[model samples]
Target: MAKILMITGDFVEDYENMVPFQALLAMGHQVDAVCPGKGKNDSIATCIHDFEGHQTYTEKRGHNFTLNAEFDQVAASEYDALYLPGGRAPEYLRLDNKVLAIIKAFAASNKPIAAVCHGAQLLTAANVIEGKKISAYPACAPEVRQAGGEYVDLQMDEAITDGKFVTAPAWPAHPALLRQLVALL
Candidate 1:
């Protein structure tokens, strides 16, 4: 079994955060879900994002996700892999230099990093996806390209693995995404 560190924050997509967290745990892997400024027993708000034939995805209130680890207490080297879930959180999490550094550390070590949808936003901010083919929410295409990484426009249920990074369009690809990540682990 592998020990994986998951960096996430408030308003993350419901399915993206919950499913992988539980599925990975169900697979007997150690998953530490953490958010900046949060500690063990602390919880963050999650939101559901889904498409309903409008302009983009619609959002709604979701569950209160609990943190199993303290962000400040964990180091990237302590884990074998890193997981980043998508949602509005990445939009702000990208502003945290500490978060970016953690991502960079994982890339430098060449550890398997699995990210879904907007999760690629953090990857772009870290400047570690350059020369890599990364898949993310379609809205993230520009950032991916600007960061020097080839943006892969995968189907909602499809995933792409380029080296140590495994990414997908959204939660619809969780099955493939987790499988790819686990294989890399």
Candidate 2:
């Protein structure tokens, strides 16, 4: 079974973090979810981002997501793949040098990386998207472009796979993202 590392932080999208974690586990993969400044068993707050016919998605408080691993103890080489859950958390996690370094290590090893929604922000910040094609939330297209990446805008349920990288627009694309990730693994 593949050992997958999932990185998330406070305000991570509820479905993005939980669904994939459980889904991968069900597939016989071992998934370790971690967050910066958090230790094993520590929890992070989640937010539900729902599309309610408004101009933008609305946020609501969601369940507490517990971390099964410690971020500081993670070594990119120990994991076969990396998962980045999307939400407001990505906005800040992308700014962490340690987070960026972990991402770079994964990329350097040619390990698969799957990111959804704002999670693509980390790819941009790590400078690892250059010349790659990715699909992310529409709002993040500009960042992808600025990073020298071609952003393929997709609907909520769609995903794009380019080499070792797979990305989707949001939580709605979990099914597609997970499928592609499984194939890569």
- Among these predictions, the greatest TM-score belongs to 1
Number of clashing residue pairs in every model? Answer: 0, 0
Which pairs of residues collide in candidate 1? none
Model 1 local distance difference test score: 0.96
lDDT of 1 by residue, 55-127 (tens): 9889998999999999998899999999999999999999998999999999999999999999999999999
What are the runs in model 2 whose C-alpha is more than 4 Å off? none
TM-score, one value per model:
0.99, 0.98
Identify the candidate with maximal lDDT: 1
Check candidate 2 and list the clashing pairs.
none
